[model samples]
Target: MPVDKTSYLLVDGENIDATLGNSILGRRPHPDERPRWDRLLAFTQERWAQPAKGLFFLNASTGLPMAFVQALRALGYVPVPLSGSAEDKVVDIAIQRTLEALGERDDDVMLVSHDGDFLEAITPLMDGQRRVGLIAFEEFRNSGFHDLVRQGMEFFDLEHDTRVFNAPLPRLRIIPIEEFDPQQFL
Candidate 1:
């Protein structure tokens, strides 16, 4: 099946960074994160028949900072802030909640994260006649998620995805800082 133009791409902010730059050594490095975003947009351009809306789910309690979220908003992504004891858990719930929102309208949902916990929440959407995809890295890829990936759920690896291109960053911008301006700092 071709990519749905009306599909919504819901991103797990932390999951995306982790899967994109994560390593066995923990918090390794990926250099540049822009290429990842570029590739993601390019993929959507080629795959979707219409412009898709990007929703980034972030954890507020994790101290993600407002400036970064504003930057993401500036980049044209809708920021859905989550607050709770655990940011990750909250993000998971937020994803499900957003999924439910889409469910009400029978709209397709695409998740760009390697979190396996979403498999259960997304299955219901799929079973209910909705579409979803997972854009993630190979290292964190779980077999359980493969079924979802195979069932019209698109999965793109940064290493293999042509949209990500060959551009690598001088450093990873995973950490949040006050008034982050890449041009001024980097």
Candidate 2:
């Protein structure tokens, strides 16, 4: 059966935070960074919404800060409560489940992560004519995962594309790169 032509986006919350925060703070944050959580969720929603099939995943069993999860939901993401392994494993499992359940009905799968660990999770989907894409930041170019990105689907950089900020604009300022500091809000 031909893969479904519809697009489906899978977001890795931790991946997004790692890349985006690095760009904003010049380094990974220390201590609590609650405000950045809001900005990240908003940015993900606006950027992934382009394909109109965004589904964000969070590792609920990890005891993620409650406020951040709520912020993600507020930004239009469907948060699933994950309970096992690392967050990467949780995300990979969720992606696999989605592909299996959809079967031939899924045409494209967009994953927002640069972690090489997910490459295996996405291989089957790519083999089946399912277009798999990545929404990762430029700093993560060292990973071999770039091979998959170059082969199967588009690779969008959060900092490179200002379109997320170019639209009518979100009620909150989550994009534009420069003004996207989440620390002030928290």
Candidate 3:
């Protein structure tokens, strides 16, 4: 079926990164050598049949590399940096709040994360007024959230098309801190 509504793509950056690293790369590479943001965004836009407003959630205390942040911006994704407080569940809470706020809108919502913590926030939005879906790694197919599928949420498996989402392993670059040059890295 053709998707006719605008999609708000909320990406759980850390969660997706870990999944892709383990499933595709076999090991997590440095953030600098990770997924090609531009390609991923294009793929999502095509899947939804509309230009999605991408919101990538990142933990503030983890400290994202400046280059990675710039690349995300260049690819048109808004980075929502939140505090990393285990006691508060900062990232998840921020995402839930955004989902709640967007629930009143007419557009569809697509969450890119396998963490089932979102179920609580997503359940209420499944009301028939707007479409809600998930973009998750197939490796997590058995994740306790399968109930979401039965609830009418569409699931897009990233593993089915690894070429688009899996970035090629980056060449090893070993250099001294004094010799490190950010320009040459990109």
Each prediction's number of clashing residue pairs: 1, 3, 0
Candidate 1 vs candidate 2, lDDT winner: 1
Q: How do the predictions measure up, each by TM-score? A: 0.73, 0.61, 0.75
Per-residue lDDT tens digits of candidate 2, residues 23-99?
A: 44566644353123334444444544533455767776658767766766776566766778553577667866776
Write the candidate numbers in order of decreasing TM-score: 3, 1, 2
Q: lDDT by residue for model 3 over 1-186, one digit each (tens)? A: 854667788888778787657755678766555556666677667776787888988888767667767878988999887776668777888999998898777788888788888888888888988778887765564465588788788887654442443544432434569978899759
Prediction 2 TM-score vs. true: 0.61
What tens digits encode model 1's per-residue C-alpha lDDT throughout 1-186? 753446687888777666555443256544453345545655764675557678888888857678877877777678888788842488888887787777666566667777777777777777646556667665566677878767766666644453563654343434447646779557
Ranking 1 against 2 by TM-score, winner: 1
RMSD to the hidden true structure, all candidates? 9.8, 8.3, 10.9
Clashing residue pairs in candidate 1 (N, C-alpha, C atoms within 3 angstroms): 32-169
Over 4 Å off, model 1: 1-5, 24-35, 62-64, 127-130, 165-186
Instruction: Pick the TM-score winner.
Output: 3
- lDDT scores of the candidates, listed in order: 0.67, 0.59, 0.74
Candidate 2, after superposition: displacement of residue 154 in Å? 1.1
Candidate 1, after superposition: displacement of residue 175 in Å?
32
- Candidate 2, superposed: residue stretches over 4 Å from native: 1-4, 22-51, 62-66, 85-88, 99-103, 162-186
Give the range where candidate 2 is weakest over 10 consecutive residues by summed lDDT: 165-174
